[model samples]
Target: MSEPRPAYYAAHEGLVAEARPKPELWRLLVGLGLVAVVVTVLNLVLFSVVVGFGSNAVAEGFLTGSTPLAMIILLSSFGFVTLGVRMAVRRLQNRSMGSVLGSFRRSARQFWVVFRALLILGLVIAVLPPYDMGAPLTPNLGLSTWLMLLPLSLLAVLIQTSAEEVLFRGYIQQSLAARFQSPIIWMGLPSLLFALGHYAPAAAGDNAGLIALWSCMFGLLAADLTARSGTLGPAIALHFFNNLIALLLISLPDNLSGLALFILPYDMSDTDMVRGWLYVDFAVMIVGWLTARLALRR
Candidate 1:
């Protein structure tokens, strides 16, 4: 007999049936478009709200600095993505939006469980041979600032990264998996889309291709973890902690560097530097997936 399907597979049967009852392809496309519009409108509203608060530094602070207000505004747009997905799911599936999270309590439990494991994993990575974290970005923001931003930043990054998971892993992956019996269609298609979206030809230059490859590999790992654990929690845990280290702990000093704790030494637009970083990123992605597997093992 074939192996049993995961619980999420059974739960989402309505969405993936041949009848396409929960969300047909046309509906999916429309939902995404609707999300795009909502995100834009919400961001504009947030920008207005921020500027009206008697602080007129949206341009400089939001684009490049350590302004706490900018940090919140810049990264909070992902909340809208979460909202958009919820709207789409509720309208199309007529199911409680919680289904996307798989098992809520279980997923939340798994998230912290995996997060602890990954933090130790991060330390292991940092201490590994031949990997230099390079210099910290200039002008440390002090203890109080970091303490203040810690909770807020976690909230921001969680919203940002979780929104992505909801879209790619929860919405897109589940939808396809519901429609197809094969893992290739359900898994690979979403990974391909995720990888393509990560490509920034202008910033990545020649390494954009490699970056896409790494992202695709990451998506594969995340998708696998989601299936393995029977919930989006492990995947979200893996993604959130990974990003917590990257975006908050260390980051490229570019337009998006406002909230980063450490700025990388190398320039993001440099082809050679980015290419070298890609190698390390690929290694990390593979290692991360393997680590998640270890954490989920019975």
Candidate 2:
């Protein structure tokens, strides 16, 4: 006798049968636009009220308004909203959220390996000639202040990174994968969106074009890793290490003892750093993709 179909599969089938047709892309886009507007307004109001008492209204307001703390709050709020919506939708279909999330969780060991890989790669870049350190390496905090804020900074990074991963690699990628069988749509769409999200930061000040190109390349690599791994582990690890390097270790000129950190032998004044870093980024992407494939092979 044939084995019985899994209850989860049966439930999925039943839901598909009764499920309403997918909404138009325009509708989805409008809903997301509204959510963005609401979040922006809420964030501004909170920041204005909270920091309004400070001496420098503009500086304090902006620091409070756009800092990682604000990002964490906004992202966590959205994460919870997404989680609730998914849970409700699953319940309506008699499905378990745990099962759904479980399907995407990766091995802890693999995750750690990816993190170590990124950390080492970043360190290597720091030590190599023509490093340029990319940006100014100035620590805003004194030793005492750093001690007090390090934990908070780390917590903020974790929250911010987790929020992005959940939104892009988890929710958006999975939804796209389910809706469209094409890997290009599942991976490319999120990658493009992620890149566009960095446009403002990347386009600000000097070397804007180079920064934007690198930012988009990073997004593409992260998206490819997510797609290949079928998990957010690699991308999260890479992003965490990327932020840590850019924020802490390499962010101090004095910290560059063993290697020259801020002076590049070759000029980086090129409009786009794409040609220079493209191969390197592509190599890292391949490593990430291959490592993920190898881990999943077992």
Candidate 3:
């Protein structure tokens, strides 16, 4: 006798079926290696081109610094990861690009549905009391400049978040679930990898472990939404909106604050303050996940 499939995973069979043909762990590992190589080579090429053509200051800041142009370039480069995923799926898995994405129409529709729910939640949170952060937020971008850059900034964030969802939820989760019956193996593994990617000790410093733990829980929640919805839409929407708030709206002054409208007085290394904020973020994330689930139920 087999274990019964949970109701939340009702739509996951379609994704698993798509992965059935090339479900080998070796294939997944090799595919990831290929993606890394592709990303490296492309970034190197881009770097060389920028350095050869641009000024020394711009060249130096392009990858390491957080100017608006630098941030846009950095975020948009994640498209290479999406391209690499496509290539790997085509070559190694012998599958179409659509194979990893479940259903295009369903994904698109769900993206809007979840995005709308989150947008409302965001507005409600914004209007609630005690909005101040114990200090006034420093203005980062001029209103006119930010407005001018909004379209491109949004596109960059969409690319970054969607690329991540395509790789983690669409490719890794689907492939793992196909090979393993247990959600612990399939969901937990990809979520762990996703968490590892966010473990930034150099930046987060003393708070790095907690930040990574937060990322792991976030990944688990995202993985859950993907499994339940059977599309990358909800996860992508969640990630996109979260990042939109962090990167485009208000941000930490020390990092990635270029395109933001306002900047926090404290940095990520301000562990005590940031840790408390992280708890708030955790609560918001949970509510957002539940909201997404409820939206799907409608």
- The C-alpha RMSD in Å for every predicted model, in order, reads 3.4, 7.9, 1.4
Per-residue lDDT of candidate 2, residues 1-298 (tens digit): 4234334222222212222344234433443454466556665775566566444644442443333343334334444434543543354333343322323445345467777665565567558776543443443345565555556655555556655665565545555554554556655677677776765533243554445566666666666665555456666777766655444333322211111112222233443442455456556556654554454445
Per-prediction TM-score: 0.87, 0.62, 0.96
1 or 2: which has the higher lDDT?
A: 1
Clashes of each: 1, 0, 0
Better of 1 and 2 by TM-score: 1
Over 4 Å off, model 2? 1-31, 53-109, 130-139, 201-206, 250-298
- Candidate lDDT scores, in order, read 0.75, 0.49, 0.88
Q: Tell me, by lDDT, which candidate is best.
A: 3
| Per-residue error (Å), model 3, residue 265 | 0.7
Give the lDDT ranking, best first. 3, 1, 2
How far in Å is the alpha carbon of 235 misplaced in model 3? 0.6
Candidate 1's C-alpha runs over 4 A off are 1-23, 51-57, 63-66, 134-140
The candidate 3 region of ten consecutive residues with least summed lDDT is: 1-10
Instruction: Estimate the overall C-alpha local distance difference test score of candidate 1.
Output: 0.75
- Candidate that scores best on TM-score: 3
